[model samples]
Target chain A: MGQATEDRGTVHTVGLGKRYGSFWALRNCEIVIPRGGVCALVGPNGAGKTTLLKLLTGLNRPTEGSATVLGQTPKQESDYLAEIGYLAQEVPMYKQMTAAQHLELGAHMNKQWDGQLAVKRLTGLGVPLDKPVGKLSGGQRAQVGLAMALAKKPKLLLLDEPVAALDPLARVEFLTSLAEAAADAAGELTVIMSSHLLSDLERVCDFVVILAAGKTQLSDEIDHVLKTHRILIGPRTAETANPAYTVIKASHAASQTDLLVRLNDVQFRSAPWHVREPDIEEIVLAYMGQTKTEGGVQ
Target chain B: MNWAMWQQHKKQWMIFGGLIAAFAVFAVPTGMHFWHVYQQALAGCAAAADCDQLADQLFRHGHDANIFDITKFAVLFMPALLGIFFGLALVGREYNDGTNLLAWTQGVSRRRWLSVKIGWTVAITALGAGIIAALSTWWWRAGNALYLSKFQPLDFAVQGILPVALTIFAVVAAIALGAWLKRTLLALGILVVILLVVQISVPTYLRPHYAAPRVYTEQLVVQGNKNRDHRPDQAPVPAHTGAIWVNYSAVVDSDGTALNWVNPPEECSYTIEEASTRIHNEERSGGTPDVYIDREGGPAVHFRCLKEKGYHWEVRYQSADRYWKFQIIESVLYLALSVPFVAATYWLVLRRDA
Candidate 1:
């Protein structure tokens, strides 16, 4: 029901932009995501996804406008950062330290660190606590990094391509652990994970934010996006523009035209076209294709 | 967070601690022995006239010479190495390995994390260097009455609190440069080059001016080697006593005008090189070279002649009493110079992206 997806003031930003020299990595990005559930941050390579994550975590400050997480500015350290956790693309760790030592570091660094939870998570993954992180496999290291982040008991977790280095199976296992942790926390945890594997995201994410060319192309509940978009097959010369539907993308063959459109409470039976609900992949691809240059639909 | 960082960098601390232990092993017992020997050599000597001979015997036969010979170079570079190693380990490697991203994103603030690292590094470095300086200073003091003065460059840099100060100064410089470059090897390379230039230049050039050298003018004297046989021309007169540093010396006429040469009678005119060669030839041919130029009236008789003609000597020197003052002054200057680097490093770390 609507109560399940209702926002609890997770993240809010106003005209958030970050510029490096003359090039803007993320510009005028205005996005709000509800609390709870896994949020998919889908974007092509160099689509400013990592830039947005860095801004939210206070690793880098915004060049323009503001960004707030958990109803507090991200720049303030103790007030907001303690409630937020971040895992970067590299999954960096002290190579010389053991898995147990990383957890020890977490306990020492974080005031609210859950050492028992960290130990349980690592042991549950079958990762030996005494093995140095450098000697561990890539999958094991990623799990260690994830455990450390989760052990901080953060309200919001920001993961930037956390599973990019993992094999497909390992990716699933990692996401499964993340899902279990989220479920255990119930409504207390909100996750925003960026990934290129749209298929993997489809299974785990309930909300999606699609970014391209330094702009937000789409932001909505995944169920709503999947429910609102439909593929229409009709005549090659069909005039598709109307108040009931908005054309997101269109393609044509010799005798047929296929259009992906956003419906505004319109009945699909009134049109002289076959209507089918588009999957998340189809909707993401259609939206990404439309913004091949520097334009996107918010 | 600070404790975690310390644990992560414990290996680096071990290496630093090992260096300090090695220096202590080399210095402590040897220094105590030297101090004992020195006290014995000076005991009950009313005017300390025989102390020089006793000290010389100790230097030639005891461990003082060997130790001094080795530590002459050790004191110049140990502090610099400590600085470079600590700087690279503290911040440069973290940046290079991209671990700062992980470290900064933790619950701890970046500034707090960096402050803890810097604070611990500086404290350990200072403490280690302080111990080394104390041992070296004690050893130097034990023999200083009979041998080298604290005014010497090596002794000045290694004694008192200067070593610790210089070490801190180098570390601050290394941290700032590493923060700017974000590369460990590059920062270390530049740090070595900078420390080398600073280590060689400051003591050699800048230290002499710390206190104005006193000038003295007196009559020239004809002197000989320890055997008191051969008389040399243009020998400088001994001006100030004790371990004063002679900055400049020259032979002058009666009116205090500089003299290029002190000519003997024209009948025995010869350069000192010619006189020396002639004397060598005499020795080779089994002939007796005159033992006293003043008495025999050879070409070297010019020294005695100039003495008779009121030829004078002028010398510029820094007396030994100002050694401690200069050491304190240089240490203060080094500490003062390090402040800006520390400020710059903090500023850059706070503002840096990721």
Candidate 2:
């Protein structure tokens, strides 16, 4: 309760874990997502991405450790839920209800619901607010579901795979509206969108958290990750040890060696090797792919 | 939130409304006709002094009793319909469609959400069941007076506040199971079984013991006394008309020991009456004489012989005067039974992960 206002608006988790029956869905998970930015959570399927989102929203209780979302324990604080908005996978709205009725539900159940904002966002994209959600197109339903999450005027909005099922055109529209909403919020709202796909998030997200096999492999600003990690192609040799940097992945050919490394210094210039800037997708795939071969299977 | 619940359950509300409308269609007309016949019968028979005959004429001899029978079934079915439509679908459908993540994550906590849902649905069920029970209670008045069965099991469930209480119990139980199972179809199946078991077992096991039955004692005539018309078993105990007979076969002795442990004194012995025997005459067996066999009286001499040993009959019964008291007690019991279910649903929704 005595924490500063800015710290309270951030999502800070420490050693958070969840187990189902005998299997742990997520363990030793730690990430702190700063406020006022769109954070992309990328992982392979079943990488505890959804689990982490649920934990933050207090939809799930962690089996071990704790999380403070918007300065409150999700399961403990009565007002904690009001600060966060969550949309589940597949965009689960009441299919039997019209989008307008869903908005009305939001109005009735939420104290700070912005019905006009949601209506404007949806109607701008030609989403039929009066039709039953079940009868809407897939992209339209996704927009309505997003409107429901956004209309609550939450400080932190958690969306699980919001654009995974949309067509290219619809995906563009969904992202366009989301970016517009984020811009409109003026840095008061923080959005975390989880997807296994990296390209869509790469374009829209400034912060990135990469999870693999129920553990966080990387969490940082996308620009920082891109700047600090690099691929170096050098002549092959048996000397693998290096104090200049840490290698994440290495492969050797007959006469050439390639190394993906996190540099000890982002400005370190390499004269003996040709260095290339890594794409965000390449960095995320490296993290996801590295864990797969090194016992990610458990 | 109240309006949200209605919007969510509008389809079920419509279906339940249709069910109640159907009940009204059947009950209103039949009830008026029944009341007319009953009023005319009372007015006609009051001067004619044929009340005994009229009781049989109005109930035991016509299709009029079927109206009461149908209404009884309707009363019994209303609660189950509420359980299925409102309770089973409340949370189970949300879980089925994955909408709980949407509903529970809104600006309200799961506890508040569930309480509003349970409270509103239970209130509606009680109100609807209350109206049906009241209507049926009014309708059964003619049958109650004519047939004198308001104290019986079939009539008791349909007559009083028990319907409202039982309906609350049904919906709460269904909600608990629905939350626990998280599947509407599965919850519906188990809820039907649970409601049936509780409804049947509670009455059979619990209702009879609510009030200690009156220990009605009387003595059958002793054998070898001045001839008694009819057999001793045919002797009717002195009880008010329409008093429910719980048990009529408990026999005891002067010292108040049950007759179950006593063997016959080298002769026939029974609880309500001594067993009779048939005596086939050795000589008159050839002629057709009143069903071809000579019938001898029951061991009336033996019951007199038993009376000589100081034995009597005890009947346990609930008099009809306690009907309203029983209604109150049972209603409280059912409402008590529903509290735990409401608690369980509360705990599951608030504590368990979605």
Candidate 3:
């Protein structure tokens, strides 16, 4: 096995594009994610979030541009794949193979497997290793996939909706175990996960990269995104529209109006509309809605 | 990783092994009876002045002479089923099971994956064919010894070897077909069609003529006078009598002219005198000679003469040039078919939209 390095893991894609015949799934998307922190890639369905992850993982190639994982081209440097753990969106598993058999196969094939860690995780999760994967419930299967990914002790982890099939409790437990595993791995674990469940992302991700219509709407530290973005509610008749506030989006329901305003707007004042701190969910939904208005949803 | 792949295919391998075992067990006894009958026929022929007479006697006595033929027929037919099964399952099972995706994602190059598959299939098929050939050969050894004196080694050689070789060839062709088709049922159908076409066509249309026996007889002419007899031309026209019976024949020329004869006449004219004499003899002696007269005696005729005069006729049997060319064309067609299948698989696997 190669010695682990201390360099921060980074994913960089420049003008990355994907198209299926006449329809473009993603186009000219440029984004850079810094290492050592969880980045939540949030988007509506068909926003090309899955495509970007696949391109980054080397499962698919871009049509126009290129992507780099840890400074190596994903397609060219498949050896680097060993250092990255990926849980595909569908999580295809050998249904006939038992959970233990799947793990054994993974251990045999993966260069970074830590058997003890996998056993401990499976045991803690109460997953019966001997049970056939097809016989297991959807949540159980997802747990098995997670255990396999975490046991690899990867430097980078890319998961596509890992908990989409799990129930609420299992989803929480899976994410909690993931966070603990990341911490136990000494923060060398850099994870990039896409999810429509913004709450789950908000719970586990430290950074956020919002994608809409196959383009990056915004990407920044979670804290910074939440702090800089605010939801304002006030009277529609209030003629005091401040110049400091950039009204990212404004929608009226009944008499009162709700405005998702960027705090960076120079005209924004501490007076008038009641300003409330926006959570990650609001931030993601705002960008999604704005992108939708700019370009109709795919 | 290799072991894991093998384990994944273990059940399939076991099934193949069981099939081979069953074939061996069923075939051994029948094959042994075939060898014993052939051995007795050869021994009887050696002890008699006329082998054909001995063959007639053996046949009349109902001495299980058909056992050898039956065994040979079974040997020819049984392996074709094995070939079809092996070919149909080689790659189709993996694609059907979706385990191929797992292997592909596990860092195994697509080329390597395909190579392993083809390698394993060819190796196992070859092994099975070899075992069948060996066991059949062993069981037929006694019959072969018995027929040694009655039949030429060449006859025995074709009887024993050609069917097995053909069966193996069909199996290989089936593998290529299955790989190209990507479906077991379709591949098997194509294989059966090919086998049926070959079996039905080869016997009637392409049977080699020269495989039959040759008989040579000459007329002794006692000239009317010693002086006239002394002259070569006056030596009663030196009547020659012979019959060249051939099942198939061919003539090849450097100028790209080729002629094939299937089931040619028993006797042919060698010269003008022979032709006239053959007609005369048919009228007078009631025996007609089938002779091919080459007036030009060009390279084409000369080549035909050379081949017909050879010891082993089938070795020079060139009647099926068109069929051989068709086989080559089919090979190219199979190669062409593989391209789209491979391209489609790669395209689906690496498509940008997943």
Candidate 4:
């Protein structure tokens, strides 16, 4: 009986979609993020990154397909919502309320709110507890927003571009808080942070999901992506594809054909072209770019 | 949730507290002075030979009316202020600030959040509005006792349960607009317009017709046919008539049915009798008979003439005694009208994406 609820601490979706009027903000999105890993949801602007996060948080309902967060169908039910903590892109807080008041609000609103944790996080950041949050700096407000989400002690934390508006130092500080919270929770917490900034996501996220247009390009372990994808410079006379590999991107020079490929097999194959392991950023960019060349992103 | 809601209300609460203090400071003293004046007027009139003249003097004094006018206007717009703060800003400002994202994503569902908010807002609004209405009504008692003008629009709109109901309606309607429009300023603009129309139209068009009006049919007095004392075409209605006259002059038949003529008050019936000619002949084959030329032009119909013919001028008016009855009627009307706004607010908040 306990295993049923325990098994749900993960996110899995099949062909999930959200449409606003005639426009689909997110569609045909299939991603699987198991519990405990920090997943980076990277996309271009208006790429449905926020849409996917909102769907998982139950802030918005899906227009098509299904999404299960922590093994429960996302909805407005308190139990379901309690299991997931959501911070919107703007990191909205009652501007008139102080950080301490926000904690009080969180405690009143959530069943398992940890006021001490929130207080500690905010106080450590030198965010004044008594001043109204609107009077605080952008970084402080974002920290308070994070503390609010953290205090809930949710199994799944869905943050939508939480640090998008902060300064560079503030961005690092915000990410550091997230990393610390994830570490403190050990493997009991799963965080999905969406942003178009690759460097901000690269340090904290062990898992990655590349979304572009209304569709998801790739979802996998970061380490796995780094290991599987290759930059192969083959002869100019050669074709781009082979039966054994999937070419994610390809370009040609007069002397050589440049290709970014994901390995289909693990075995060491005698290939004609030289291979170089591509970094996560390069792989993400390649996948994101692969969609654009096919056209019709907007 | 309570703390957050309190944050929303903090500004309004402070302002309300200040208003209450001002009213207490001003109303109590004024009320006492008016009471003193009223008692003195009554005591002086007891021994006076002409109490009607003294009463008229008291009515014309309007001792408390000017000061009460401020309170009256304050009570009037207090509900409109509720529309701006509670109704229009309730959901609309949250959306405006992008805070609904934070709010709706809480462990509580949107509908529950809205339900709690609306409950708190409406309860407190009605309570505050009740206080204002009651205070204004109590303060105006000395003057109302003198004039009994509670049925008048200005008096009715600010007194009794009517203000409370109007306030609830304002907030609820504003809430619906906020939810539907999803913009604070726009919702406020529309809400103000709606409330303006409601306040003006409800009194001018709807309040007087809350119940069927009664007819005050005067017994006609007959003067001697030779004497015609000029009574103005429309008699001036007394201030203390204890009714709001919708129609001051209407001719009613013996059955008390109002005539639907172009001008009902001008309707009259007459007949030209045969002429009895008075002619004198000095010398003729036969003596001449007396002829009455009054037949050529008979006496014009006069008030006394019409009065004797079972025609009386009726005053159509809503009775002042039915003041509370109409208050209840209109209060129920406003409250019932607010149900749709409440429903729409809930539905919109629940269904719309945060």
Candidate 5:
């Protein structure tokens, strides 16, 4: 019932910058995300994640450089917006309106709405159609917002912590729906979700973009990032000797020292030293720390 | 566009329409009753023989039902409220509900969004104003016809329509203020302050001044013999007191004599052969009549009578002289007040962020 998979334009930027007076919300940030894949943007509070999303959605204009959504200028093209579904951080829905009303309003305005897909998604998420959004719980409200965004059947989905406020059960259900929705198109739908929940992003994100202090610390495939980085635990004396390894970061707790090392060369050998794959959380924190030490967040 | 303007705002429209309808139903009958009461008071004064007593009664009657009391306060207040509500809710609700952002992001430009909002508000305001105007006009027509026979329906132009237009302008201006401010309560505060200042200031300091004639009547007796057929020397009649004599005419020959010479542009003077002073109250019953004197201090052919009634006056002149100038001046003033509102609304909408 839908068109076959085709290549959509990548999310590309060149020296994109956003400034609020003297404070740089995001500056000198350049990154590229290939088409039709899931990318998670992980950042802490006040790290300009929301500002970056606003700029990418054209809700806010960039102070310098340029960013494109599907090869169209985000600020100028309204047609591109129709193809891009955005769920802002707060999910700005009419409070007095019901979930069904929000969906209906969105469907009426967007020509690309797929009624069957929307119905299936709503039912799957157990979102009450008859309940007014204001009367629903926070988790239900977030689900309603997600349903409205998905009803448009957009080519690119930009979600800002879509499940952050959800309960454990609701959060899992919400992410499952996202995975199913993306799977239905056979990886054709590209999703860029920003969240602080690394474990939740680990379940669905194929790519990870870690940002610290308004700049990109790391942006790569999840598998490549985990494979290229390792957590090495060795003696404090050996760590202090600075063995032959690209040390991303090293910290001492009691007598054991934890080293986050980039395994660019695996020739380093030390007695009683163990190497294990770095978890996504460790990799993100290491990059965050590195950015922090370099004067400020990028 | 249709969905955003109509469906989204349907409930608000229904509430506004019901309120306006209720106001109209209430105002029309009350306005009619006041008009009737105005007539009764005037008739009661006219029945008295003592001129001073009659004048005193007329003054009290005017104090009770002057233009400001009968028309301005009674008829214009409801219309102004309707206008304010129309303005406060027009764009204030959209910004509050966050639906405006949804509409803006959905390909509706900010200009188009504001246009639709202002268009709908103006349409509703015009309808509400038209209803109030029509109802008030009908009530005033019946009341004026019954009581103040001299009152013309065209007087509604001043007492009714002008205030309605002013109130409507206030409403549109308030709505624009609401959109620019983006908060209903703040907009309402600003609107109230501006309206209070305008209402107090415009009527007192800036209201236009209109020129009206003054009329004075006097009785004069002649001492000359009636049978002699002689023309006694006519004394110069002084000009009417406190009035400028623009024209002079005489009703000549109580006995069917055509005084063709007294008909044209020439001015005349008649003598006070005998005089009687009748005082009804404390003031002089018949004040000293002004004599129109010529250069030689001789009586002229014609004399003008002037009577002052506050801003308006009655004279030997036609009614058109008083009515036309007042109407034109008020209309121009009303038109001038409306321009700032229109210009401000346009500028605010053009520069407002989506």
Candidate 6:
């Protein structure tokens, strides 16, 4: 991926950290994502994914170093906030308020709120405007929350485990809606979503950022990551020693060994081995496991 | 934004508006009827020497007595209720329900949201309280001379600018507490307790200390048969009238030792018994007697003895003319005290986690 630039990047953080009573929830999290990049933040539970998202959205303030989302400090200025849309984990809404009323409130509260877009999306999805939000199904509520976020027409959209509570069908529908929105925007809207379901992300995201134990393990264009990481299955000691590939993970079975390695480019190096491109899920799992072995579980 | 906010909270606003409007409907007419009765009674007693007696008659036979009683009762506790209902529900419920996350993530800044909410609350509270204060004050004016003085605790608490000031205080206090606590019911409970303490303590303890009372010392006198002690030998200090609030009344020795008749000395037994007898007889004849006795004899004899022994009377009082001044001072004080609480709430909200 290209380096983060003030005008080109939608989000960048430098040594960003968050602490609660001496317990660092997220620490030393440095990340850079270019504008209009569909980034997927993949991490295990307690991997600071939510913390990072909160910081980016200005829903939270970093306890450590600075972060710039849309080239402004989080939670500092209203103008910057206006350009970002954030959907929290719970999808909280006023139970007594109808969907139409919520839209009315959004139109009132936001200077750049797109009322027509919000109404069209809701009506198209068959979400009744007169029904109270409390009476809606779980999937409907999440869609409503997503609609609220998208209606802002933000420069960047942050979703924290948006589909974690959805059923299998609902999960697909949610992702489809998000992917459709990103497609419609056509390289103008930057969307960063955090999810444990790596497969779902693989279908939608072009950029991948892997985090574990409050630290970022890998962040790059998804194509670049896929091209650099490879899985080798071969004999335990039938390889030439070279400085080309860095071993990320390895497992030995009797006389055979399976090795996951990161390299500048995938190539054969005169070995009795089988090399295959590692999927995003395998790469993320290797990185998360690597952090645990390195004792980064603070 | 203002219009949308009004639409969102219109239900709560309507409830509050309905309640206040209903109260006005009941209170205004009753107050007018009270004024009518009060005027008639005053005019009827125009030829009489004592207008105080005629005023008392209005209190006894007034058609608005029940309504006045209910309205005063409402005023006494309405501050707490309003604070808990509007203040806690406005912000506290947002936290409780976690809608603050949705709200804060919107384009609106947290500070702007709070300022608008507080501004609306203050305006609505002021409107409701202003109407109640105007109607009640107008009604009380005609009968004030016969009823309790404006300096009295109940009278002072619900009049002029105090109701408005108190409404704001209640709401701000509730907001601060709600922000800190996060739970609506818990915050409301604490608000009620705090308001109760404020309502009772402000009048009973804080008010009396607002300004130093005037000290009046007069020579002891002996009245013959004017008091309950009809034996013609008992006398005591009389309370001051015409814009003076009596805080304390006592007969003292030259050394300023407060004399006690509730626990009279051994030497005062004969005088006390004789005075008690005459007072009991007068009460049987449906007369209200002012009774006091000393160890020497009846009040007449005892006061003469007290003068011979170099005794006098002392009274501590607040002037009625300072009533408006005290009200203004108290309202300002309440509003000023609410500032830090409001600041603390804002700080907590700013620092709170999602």
Best by lDDT: 2
Candidate 2: which docking quality band?
A: medium
Model 6 lDDT per residue over B175-199, tens place? 8888888755678778888888888
* Regions more than 4 Å wrong, model 3: A1-9, A76-78, A235-247, A270-272, A290-298, B41-118, B133-354
lDDT of each: 0.78, 0.79, 0.61, 0.78, 0.62, 0.78
Clashing pairs in 1: none
The sequence of per-residue lDDT tens digits that candidate 2 reaches over residues B205-312 is 888888888777777554322233423544345455474636444556787776543344454343322232221232255532111101132222345555667777
Candidate 6, clashing residue pairs?
A: B233-B298, B233-B299, B233-B300, B233-B301, B234-B298, B234-B299, B234-B300, B235-B299, B243-B320, B268-B295
Q: Native contacts retained by model 5, as a fraction? A: 0.21
Per-residue CA lDDT of model 4 for A11-99, tens digit only, reads: 88889999999999999999888779899999888899989988888878899999877767888878887887888988887888888
Candidate 3 local distance difference test against the native: 0.61
Is 2 or 5 the stronger prediction by lDDT?
2
State candidate 2's DockQ.
0.65
lDDT of 5 by residue, A1-298 (tens): 1122122236777778888879999977777776778899887777777778778877678889888777677752447667777887766677777777776776656667775667677777677888778888877777777677777777778888787777788788778878887888676688999986466678998898878788887778888888788788887767334446677788887878888877766676745677888778777878767423342322
Q: Can you tell me which runs of candidate 2 are displaced by over 4 Å? A: A1-9, A75-78, A234-238, A252-257, A267-274, A290-298, B42-50, B53-55, B61-63, B221-237, B251-265, B269-311
TM-score (2 decimals) of chain A in model 3: 0.88
Model 6 regions lying over 4 Å from their true place: A1-4, A233-244, A247-259, A268-276, A290-298, B43-66, B218-244, B260-304, B351-353
iRMSD per model? Answer: 1.4, 1.7, 3.5, 1.5, 2.9, 1.6
Q: Give the chain A TM-score for each candidate.
A: 0.92, 0.92, 0.88, 0.92, 0.88, 0.91
Question: Lowest summed-lDDT stretch of 10 residues in model 2 chain A?
Answer: A289-298
Ranking by TM-score: 2, 4, 6, 1, 5, 3
DockQ-derived CAPRI band for the predicted complex in model 5: incorrect
Off by over 4 Å in 1: A1-8, A234-237, A240-243, A252-256, A268-273, A290-298, B32-67, B141-143, B222-241, B252-311
Residue B352 displacement (Å), model 3: 9.2
Q: Candidate 5 lDDT, tens digit per residue, B1-354?
A: 556467566777898688767766766666666567656765775676433243233324554447424654555565457556677666666666655555555544456666777777777776666676667666555343333322233243434455556656677777777677765667878887876776666543443234433333233222222322222223222342211222333323333232343332332334423111111121253443332322243334323321111111112321333444554565466557667765676676554433
TM-score of 1: 0.85
The 10-residue segment with the lowest total lDDT in model 4 chain B: B274-283
